[model samples]
Target: MNKTDRLLAIVLELQRKGVLRAEDMAAKFETSTRTIYRDIQALSEAGVPIVGAPGLGYSLMEGYFLPPVSFTAGEAVALMIGTDFVEHKFDSDYRTKAQSAREKIEAILPESVSQETNRVRTTIRLLVTGETYNSGREKEGLEALRRAILDKRKVRFHYSKNIPGADGNRHSVRDVAPYGLVFAQGSWILVAYCDLRQELRHFRLSRMSDLTLLEDSFTFPTDFNLQDHKPADDRRVLVRVQVHPDIADKVKGAGSFFMTQMEDHEEGLMATFHVRQPEELLHWVLGWGADVVVLEPESLRNRVREEAAKMLKGY
Candidate 1:
């Protein structure tokens, strides 16, 4: 491995093992102990917070955090692409934070790696067209919600439902114990336990206003695992679709989180997805236009036809 790469690997080894001997590092990297000593000296000179004891080898100083480690060209490009997506697609407040982080990554990268990363970044593009998220109007609410989630505090907010019920009151006050924040379907959703509803609910950050972090604190449930928790509307239907060969990869990449199975065919790619709602599948299929065909679940096909007819009528 290159010396620069090896130096970075040594830092990673020290981090993982808390301490590493020069002999062990040499054996792992297939280099001489003399070379390892030189590398250690170089790293210490470069302000890496490395400390050595007489017999204990080398380790990072306690409480010293090495800024993110070096990245390969491909990894750097991927990070830039992902941050760019978040900068465009996420809330404005988060977009600024993501941009700041990307700048830091760029600033710390070695010049050679930075140049190749820039080359790859220029060659790759992620285009987000159409109105995916609300503008930055909900910045305060989102920030408050995040703070509440982090502090394990209850929050009170007035929410204006996109569709009001028969009572015709557009807004209602709710008290919830914020558990997690989820970014999905182009919106920030607060996954919280609603004191009023007496159950967990998802509240769109955009629809929330007049948010206040309550002084009252709550204990998060020990058994509540965010990864395993599903939204209340978690009923799924298996929907199949045929994707045109030209755009199959794009479709799969975008929907990889929800797609269950895919098979390559002569004409195109056949894909099955466990979709929570037909509207979600409808919107996705419509985005592909003629490049995608909904093959099963008559309900989804009919919904697509109905929505397409409405679009045609508008034109």
Candidate 2:
């Protein structure tokens, strides 16, 4: 960051955090302590009310705040897009807040900048895919989970996994201490400490039902940071399928998340997928019928045969 931008950011950080040590500021801005000292001196000379002590850190004077800042047209457009995303992706409560935020941003922008931002935004669109994106039930579940995460409370719900358990049952009841909410691949996933399993697990909001907030509360782990948490990757199964050339473009357009690679083949198009289990691609393969053929993993082929036989019986 330039000196001017860094100076403004340091002041904003002080205002937000109340106080910060020189070492802490140096680390945050990724600069040397000497640079931070110089910046603080510069701010002091410019009439910024920064008070520092020998041991304690530097702090902004009580009741001091920076005046309204200006935004370039590009910056304005970026903010507008962010608000648009929040309005569409979040629940009713946050949707209202995003609308208010967008209004405030537009009110502050110059008329020319506002017009330019609106024109640019019109050329870009955020499309919603899948049934779970804006479903009322999904929205309600997300909102409930959000409240649970913020309140440090436990929640109870019945979850339906794609694969059945050893008992041939796909549904199970769970009581978990909510840790965080993640939005990935057009789905809302709740990362929590599962009471039954005694470990952290990810539950898709769309597969959850009868979600209820419990009065029982739990303490969030101080060491656990949602931003740094990396879930184990379990998609080990490799699936290869051959698609007829006639529908190759359509299959590519589908944009299946599991698909890792696709290439033209002598027979047709060779498409490869990575999944947690072979069953995850069952219905997807069946959707193409004769146009698609599973090349390996004999288990998936046998299962497909059985399912096709069952369909013949129904006819």
Name the top lDDT candidate.
Answer: 2
User: What's the alpha carbon RMSD for model 2?
Assistant: 2.9
Question: How does residue 153 of candidate 1 score in lDDT?
Answer: 88
- lDDT on C-alpha atoms for all candidate structures: 0.83, 0.90
Distance (Å) between predicted and true CA of 2, model 1?
9.7
Which 10-residue window of candidate 1 scores lowest in summed lDDT?
161-170
How far does residue 54 in candidate 2 sit from its true spot (Å)? 5.2
Model 1 vs. true fold: TM: 0.57
Which residue pairs clash within candidate 1?
none
Q: For residues 205-255, what per-residue lDDT tens digits would candidate 2 score against the true structure?
A: 888899999999999988899999999988899999999999998999996
User: Candidate 2: where is the Cα deviation over 4 Å?
Assistant: 17-35, 53-58, 131-134, 164-169, 263-267, 312-315
Per TM-score, the best of the predicted structures is: 2
What TM-scores do the predictions have? 0.57, 0.87
